[model samples]
Target: MTDDDLIARLEQQERDLLFSRFDFADAWRLGSLLVEMATERGLPVAIDIRRGPQQLFHAALAGSTPDNDAWIERKARVVERFGNSSYLVGRRLAAGGRELDASLGVDPARFAAHGGAFPVRVEAAGVVGVVTVSGLPQAEDHALVVEAIERFR
Candidate 1:
């Protein structure tokens, strides 16, 4: 599909994935769901859930490495900074014939506009957290997180 088409789908995902409330227990359930899915599929994924600056849940499955953790942080930063799924942000930039760069005021070091990170948006509280996964291909990484959230909420 085209970048615009992908962006539209991601927008719909963000809108549909909203939560009424999110807390530590909710974080545990969501994170655990992702973990179970990965384990069932034997997906070597690292999952992370965060509320603002505080990390709530983290897991590294077999074959997952520290690099996956780093990727999670970068992708989550993209969600926190842009208030959109990391994949959506990247697609929007590409559709505009742009990318992450100094001119865009986005630091590649700290923020990666790649798939894998999704915002944990609470309708009443706005975007209060991020859910991220890494290890698979970028889009699959994104789809994994999205699927978990869709199941959780």
Candidate 2:
């Protein structure tokens, strides 16, 4: 899809994927659901869920590497910093015809404006955490997290 199309889809995703309630138990359920989906599809992925600086769930499936873990961290940083999906942030940068380095003073090494990490927004509570997956293409990684969250909700 075109960049604008992708951005629009991500925007809609951010708006639609809201949880009525989210907690530690919900994190476990979402993580497990993502793992099951990945295992069933033979997808090599790493999953992570976090609230503020506290990591709630983490898993590295078969074929996933340490890089996947690192990607998850960077992507999660984007969500925590901007309170938006990593994909959406990345797309917004592109939509503005800018790069992360040129548009923001933030170090690219610490935060990535890529897909995968999505904010866990609770109604009335706003963004409380991030759920992320790494290993697939950026869009696929983002889609995986979105699908898992949909199922979890």
Candidate 3:
């Protein structure tokens, strides 16, 4: 899809996906679901769920490495900072001929606008947490997280 098409779809995903209330239990359930889906698909992914700075769940499946963990942290930071899915932010930036990383003259170490992390938006509570996956292609990582969220709902 074109960058604009993808951006529009990602925005819709953000709007349509909402949690009534996301607690520790909810984190566990969603995290576990991501793991299960990844395992079934044989996707070597690293999954993480967090509330602000507090991490609630994390898993690094076989074949995943420290790099995947770093990607998770970076991508998660994008969602946490922008309150938008990392994929959407990346697509928007790319469309403008910029990037979330150093190519845009921005700090490259902490934030990654790649497609993997998603904000956890709760009803009336706003975006409170982040859910992320790494290892697959960025779009696949994004889709996997979205699938788990849908399954959890």
Q: Which candidate is the best by TM-score?
A: 1
CA lDDT of every candidate: 0.93, 0.91, 0.91
Model 2 per-residue lDDT tens digits across residues 20-131: 9888999999999999999999999999998778899999999999999999988998998889999899899888888777357678988998999999999999999999
TM-score of each: 0.97, 0.95, 0.95
Among residues 3 or more apart in sequence or in different chains, the pairs in candidate 3 whose N, CA or C atoms overlap within 3 Å are none
Give the Å error, residue 153, model 3.
0.8
RMSD of each: 0.8, 1.2, 1.5
Could you tell me the TM-score of candidate 1? Answer: 0.97
List model 1 lDDT by residue over 18-109, tens digit each: 99999999999999999999999999999999999999999999999999999999999999988999999998988898888788787898
Pull out the clashing pairs in model 2. Answer: none
Clashes (backbone N, CA, C under 3 Å), per candidate, total: 0, 0, 0
Off by over 4 Å in 3: 101-106
Which model scores highest in lDDT? 1
Clashes of 1: 0
